[model samples]
Target: MQKDLIKELCLTQDLIDIAGTGTASQSSTSKWSKENDAQRAVSGKEFKDFAFHTDMETNPWWQVEFEMPVAVEYIIINNRKRSPFDERASELSIVAYDNEDNEKLLHSGTMYFGSEDRGCPLIIPLKGNVSLKKLRITLLKEDYLHLSNISFLISDPLRSFGDKPVFIANRGDGLGERLRALLNSMVLAKEFDGHFIFSWPLSFSKSEFHAIDNPENVFGRDFIDSYLVTRDVLNRCEIKDLRNTMDFISCDNDDYKKIGINLDQNSLKNQIKDKNLQPKNLISEYKLAFEKINFNEGVTEAINLAKSVQLKDKVLGIHLRTGDIVYSDYRYMDRYYNKVVPFYTVESLITRYLEMGYDIVLFSLDSSACRYFKDKYGVVISNDLIPEEYDDIQRAFFDIVLMSRCTEIVGGLSGFAILSSWIGGSKISTYKKILSEEEIKSSFTHSLSENGVLSSGFISPLLKSFSIAHYLQSFKDFSSIIERIELLKKCIEIDNGNNYYRLLLALDYYKEKNFSAADGILLEAVNSTDKSNIKWLAKTKFPKITILSIYTLELEKYASQGSIVAAYVAFLSRYYYDEIDMNIAFYKDFIQKQHNNKNSIDTEFLKEIQEKVNLKAENL
Candidate 1:
């Protein structure tokens, strides 16, 4: 008696045969044609009733196509329990093909056919959740292929993920350290397939900690609530259990073993000194999810300060980092950098920027450093001009905001320096060796050239204005949306066809639930052939089917043209029409472009991404 082989699993659960026409390397002369009928093997009935048989060959292969890309957890293969052919499925390889024609080797080597004495259903669990359009099984060393049944357990997103989520209890760390922790957690959440509770409380007292501003004080309360899932929310009845029961994890402990391919030994030593300071292993797919940190009142005030100070558009920003840093962390700095570079004094950096034709230089330093620069260069730091009660935390936030507005930034080795330069959106220059006038001259000579100049004023205004609009959209406050819309409209009137402004206007409409108005603007922005707009478009969830279809069509058109942003958008599209191939294409194109440009640091970053995707840099 052939006992019921399939047990434990809900054989009658929401089962569907999504397999399309199947093809094989070679067809069998038997009636079980290697065509669409191969899907019949998926039928949960007795294995003897149906099987996908193929003719004898060196390496025979059989493939099943799914109607759409489905998130698969595991696949169960039923082998014939009969005599000789029982072990036919022993050495086989399974490959999954996404819609973009990218192939992933899901399973290989020996089969999971439970032992000879007491065989169970051959279940092959996927390592991670993946979306696939087709699956192929090939005989590696075997001469024949016989597949009884191939069934997959599609993923249910609503179901809790098996592994517990992580949360961190951040101590009184510097703002940069805190931010790095947040960034690290984002990486963990993506890799581990779990949520993260941002547990850093806004209000805490630490005499040792120089800066400790509530997140709401820097980024608006409304903005933080919308984008970031706060720790306060985690304490709620519905979520508290999940937080308490789930594992408590911290990114500080993550060794970042995967981040060594791109950096040299010296650079690696500096980065790894503090785990929190390690350069983020950025995953493009997770970019939208990491958009939690945005601008707030602090940022707004920074912009107003920039304007009020009348710091010329082409100002240079310098973080000499010689205030509390020189005395408190001198040993720490010496360890990483090998020696003290004396040329990074306040007067020297200010003079350097001035020599490069910068009208002013924004200084994010202690008042002592500020006074030193003023005494020598007769230049008052921007912070000195702004009248306010400035605590260390508040001052640090102000400095960060101000630095982010700079056209170009040069700094010493510090995580805060790195953050300011990055958020400022410019080519960052750092000094590792002894900073001589010659070295400074060699670096700034290009800046002194016209080609090195960036539109100093535009980045800040664009980012700040968009931040406000994004905040309003997140809250879905109709009245605020109206005000935002008016502001964006005014910007558009001044600078027509600015995609960022247009996207903000569109989002304002989307927040107001005016899909029609939003669609009109989105359609215009999408048609412009600018890839930047695609990220914004991807963030939006259209309420109307017609608008969604239109947007998808426009996105496809751009994606086909090899726009990485469009391809990314298609990958993130809510309609689930995108495949892994789009991501592959986007990365290939992006790597090729970045590789051509000889920016060593940026190229290293690209190489890190290449390593993440298992793609060899030389191959491209």
Candidate 2:
């Protein structure tokens, strides 16, 4: 039977297990039993014992003999259970016998087990080689051991395999909303599979490591097959290097093969091409899209009504955007505006235009700002017909359509405002000055331009200073204004109503403020019927106030050009209280002269002026 069994084992190429029998109480039926006095016992010369266990006291001992003397470097003991043993294994020992048949112990140590011992079995190294034909068994506890099956696996020495690869997709949390959009493009590129692993920087505890010993916890049942105590490997160089290496590949390099990935470059290029192939890429597309959408019929009717009643030779479309510096912070809580319009910058820009003698048919996004402008600067706004809840994009589209009908545009440095100027086939003007690199790097809070306009590209001082100065000067030049307006009109007409001509117009207007008859002409160019919340002075009240203050001061010199004592006095009275000390005496003397000649001014107007002057003097 033994010979047949050996032949069967040889034929199957499987390891053979020797079972022992004992009495019922101290039964040899346990599969692993120390030899009885009656049973033949092999006196060991030199041998090693490898034990397999299911639990603490349930380990089964095994003895094996080789055909020839072979050196055993390591033993791989497989635990087939789904769970690991609760207690630690006692000992792994190598015993040798001298020529006198005396057993001598060589080496012994406790064997350690991992969290999931069943998944990763223990590998114990042997100290030395021993010559023996047979080995003896000593059964310890049997808590987790199954007496029915026992076997041993032996293998030669090999290098250890490194840890599993960990993949991370690192992106700023502020970009979370746009991540889906960006990922949409990425997914189409076929560079990455849908499966992704998220590794949060924070979310682990040391106590969680002990829970890994449980089969359900370690295996994660159906959820995950593998998990690591991340904190344990937190500072590990291998982990950091792997994460950094992957980040370089996925983000920085943008090269596929360098990071061991295969992708079709042609397909990716085609996808990018498709994005650029949007219908709105053409001028005809803009016209079609605009025409297809039936805009405010009421606004269009109002424009038609205004045109039929009285026509201005020129219509200037004004768009103002108030930006809050605090909103630039990436946190969600502070991203939105506290008010509808940013008043300070808008007011400043508007004041500049008013000084140039521009009749602004302002289209403001801030309703409150529009009222304020009308009350303060007497600027007529045309956006009251539009809805309040329209989002920035929708407002932009509406502004484009409205601006397309305008002769000139005055815009603030905002995406919405700029888009309006771009859409308005008109001469456009902006209030901001380009900064030099040195200027940008300075510590002043007001020096920084919005939306990265300063550092966008290399800009020459001549081009910048001249552009701003020219736009300011243009506001006072009729011929220059006409030329710029005509140039913008031509660009828009030739470019299928493209806004680039308008941007150029704005650039020129921004360079030189020529507030001439073209202001009325520019005002005539817009569709007054299109009402939007943007037309409200409340949207631009603060900026309107600020810009008006600046323009009023700048045009203070021009008020005397008329030499009407009453008009000059009126201008001085309106601006004197706000002017700095440098011009305070000039305004004060002009006011005194007007007051002395009471015949030139109406008695009521003079009394009101005197009252204001007295109030100012009292405050001082």
Candidate 3:
């Protein structure tokens, strides 16, 4: 398991063709068209003799055809090594086409050069088992996409748990929250005949993170083949239940029942009420569930490392989450509103722990915050103990597990710290309000035990409103205004507390020239005749003009605090208001400032708006 345990090879030793925009000449007399070139590429050899080369083009392609439909788990591409001038396949995309000419994009990314001259292979793990008759590699950027080797791993459909309900556990949240979610989900999933596939930090996984080149390592070859990443076993396989991070976090049995699974929470609740079920403490209950599940090598290693680092009942843990929150705009509220926790005033808190006979203070913190804590208190930062070569996810996983080893914990507002405190079963003191265990219980759609034991939980009123509002607001396109209004009206019937939802409904009405209805709702939501509200009164072909304007004004006080959608809306609002001079000035400013900073703005919408405003402004 330590070595790169490549699954069984299923690639045929056939001569593939190079034919595309710039591939005609590449097929003649070149290293690409060399006899046995394609065969050598997939023959598990990374030597220059086994490489295939193509000419540079805007869009060059190399394709290989399998004799029959083969289930592809994943593909690895090793670039040719020509040393100094070796321009590796920098940015490329992989596409799979079936016999019927149906195609799907499998993976896309830059082929990063690993350590030394040996370099690293670019691994493209597909989402699930994809049966493709032909596979093609296309260069996204202008370059020759060279290949030293093309290795294919076939999927084993007969793998165990194939019959069980499958859930893809992809947590895009902070590491600690993700682990907490996984623990909760595994508990609920066990209520039904459920299995899970953990795909975290998916496309960004690197060989350096795995280190040692041993497959048995947490991120090693065997670990990846078994769990994580998207592979053929992931493709074409039937998923009885599929939930994203949010869906999994807030899912109930009703959600499952909607997907035709008859797992009912009400039955379980009735059984519990009738004393037909033995009640268990929620924490220990989930602990038992977590015990039943098997974590991948990565998680197991993290837990082991945590155990090794734990002091004998004298460790004090403190988590300072300062990276993203410091830069986060608090004025504009995002979907989930976890209260921000401050760490600057915690010196006294740590001093008390030190005086109370704690031998070690294990500080889990980001790079920016680590220095401050280390210098001020002379404590050990978790990052120093972890290998720097580990990727962000690996580092995050390790940090959380390490924090969980403490006897007592003082945490920030971060779910990372909160979840760690919970896992460690420590006396937790958090700076901000955390999600209550009652809320967690209510968030459950339904729960049932393996032996048909069931417990039903109520959905929070606010959660229900948010869920309906999210679906209704998703139809932001003008073309869907009519359908959107209908849906919003229905949502309002169920939950009318969301003023934002009402504003959306009003915008739809204004778009349809229902001035009376639009004005009524707008005034009710804001109760003002301010200049900002005038845009809502104005007629425009696109409702987004009014909709975006409304959000910008409503969240104007929270202007510094905004989501990507808010920024996008704010950009559109400027254009709709005919602020051409301001638009041009801001665009120039954006270009200048973004030279050093990441452009997190809505560039696509900006471009479209710029083109339209440029035309209109010229006439003015």
**Per-residue lDDT of candidate 3, residues 445-523 (tens digit):** 1211221101112223333334334334322442267777776676566555434556677656756766567646654
Query: What's the true lDDT of residue 454 in model 3?
Result: 18
Residue 81 CA error for candidate 1 (Å)? 59
Quick one: best TM-score, which candidate? 3
Q: Could you give candidate 1's per-residue lDDT for residues 147-259 as a string of tens digits? A: 66666654222122233444332333456656555544455455555444344454433533346655555666554543343332223213322122222223433322211
For residue 340, give model 1's deviation from the true position in Å. Answer: 8.3
Q: Give the Cα error of residue 346 in candidate 1, in Å.
A: 4.3
Tell me model 1's lDDT, rounded to 2 decimals.
0.48
Candidate closer to the true structure by TM-score (higher is better), 2 or 3: 3
Model 1: pairs clashing at backbone N, Cα or C within 3 Å: none
lDDT at residue 543 of model 2 (Cα atoms): 25
